[model samples]
Target: MQLFYQNLLPEINYLDQDESKHCIKVLRKQQGDELDIIDGKGTFYKAKITDASAKKCRFEIISTTQERKVAFHRHLAIAPTKNMDKMEWLVEKATEMGIDEISFFQSFHSERKVIKIERLEKKAISAMKQSLKAKKPLLNEIIPYKQFLKETDVSNKLIAYVDFKNKIHMKNELSHQQDTLVLIGPEGDFTPEEVSLAIENRYKKVSLGNSRLRTETAALAAVHLMNLAME
Candidate 1:
């Protein structure tokens, strides 16, 4: 089934602008062609083409369904990088790997600030549809590290850091039953004060592995390990 994204629904007879172009002009789908629509919050509808205008192809819902939630909940918070390509790639991969929520934080040594979330949201929806997943991940607005910490609430809090002077590993520290929040630092890593503050708040220190890793790599590795721990 051809899948399309529309965040709003009860969306009676609305044609997806880009997907409509793809349907009418690219795929050349005509009226009555069967398609599927996702509202990105677990809602899936089976629809048929009603109007096939390249810019405004319309559809009618035939049936609707929702998917079951995952066995474990996850949220990954990372410092946004200076090179946006890496950050964008992280968003895509995290969505494919089944992350529940993503937050971009401006860390002490972070090189970038003021991320544009709309593009990331679009990337996430595209990845979700491509993965054939029924639930879409939440893309949070970028914020400062302190504010992010103040606002987030999770059962387990983990900070991925490599202190040559201090040793810790995520595998040994994370609890399987609790919803987790992992903080992946910037390229330069989190400042000593930031690490101290996080530890003060009960955020455990953990390492993704022994080898040194880039910020994006650490973030993705954290996501992978979290999924594995739940499994």
Candidate 2:
């Protein structure tokens, strides 16, 4: 089924400019054509086009369906890489894999201190629509590493970093049916003191695998592990 997104539902019955153009001009959808619409809030709508205007394609909802709530939440917190393209790739893939939330933090070794959250949000929305998911993952603003750990209040908190002595794999450490939050460090990795601070805050240190991975790769790996554990 072809899915379109319109965050404001019931209250609003028109697709925005971008979506309108895509539906009318690109897809050649005309009045009276049927379309599937989602509000990115776990709600789906069966709509019929009323006006095929490329700027403000209007539709009337024929039916509404609410999706079931997920059993657990998968929140992936990481230090974004200097190259935003990599971070965008991670966000897109993670959204397709059913991530519930993504948080960005700046660590002592963080290369990219600044981030464009608006751009990432667009990427996430496109991915959600492409993957045919009705719900969109929460994209959080970048905050200091310490602030993130202190503010985050999830039950299963984990930190993935390079530590030979800490041999526990994230997959094995995951608690089934519980909300989880995993931390992935920057390319330079987190400092020992930072790790200690996380531990002090009750975050368990875990490993993704034996092979060392880049910042984005490590973050995606943690996301994948969390998805698997939930399954």
Q: lDDT of candidate 2?
A: 0.91
lDDT of 1 at 95: 89
Count steric clashes of candidate 2. 0
TM agreement with the true structure for every prediction: 0.93, 0.96
For candidate 1, give the lDDT of residue 209.
Answer: 83
- What lDDT is reached at residue 19 by model 1? 76
Which candidate's TM-score is highest? Answer: 2
**In candidate 2, how many Å is residue 35 off?**
0.9
Cα error, residue 57 of model 2, in Å, equals: 1.1
Q: For residues 155-211, write the lDDT of model 2, one tens digit per residue.
A: 989999767887889988876689999999888888999999999999899988888
Clashing pairs in 1: none
User: Which digits, one per residue and each the tens of the lDDT, describe model 1 over residues 1-231?
Assistant: 567877776555666688788778888888989878888888888888888788877788899898777767789999998999898899999888889999989988999987889889888988999988777889888899998888887779999988767687897766567789999999988999999989877888888887789989898989988888877
Query: Which regions in candidate 1 have their CA more than 4 angstroms from the true location?
Result: 164-166
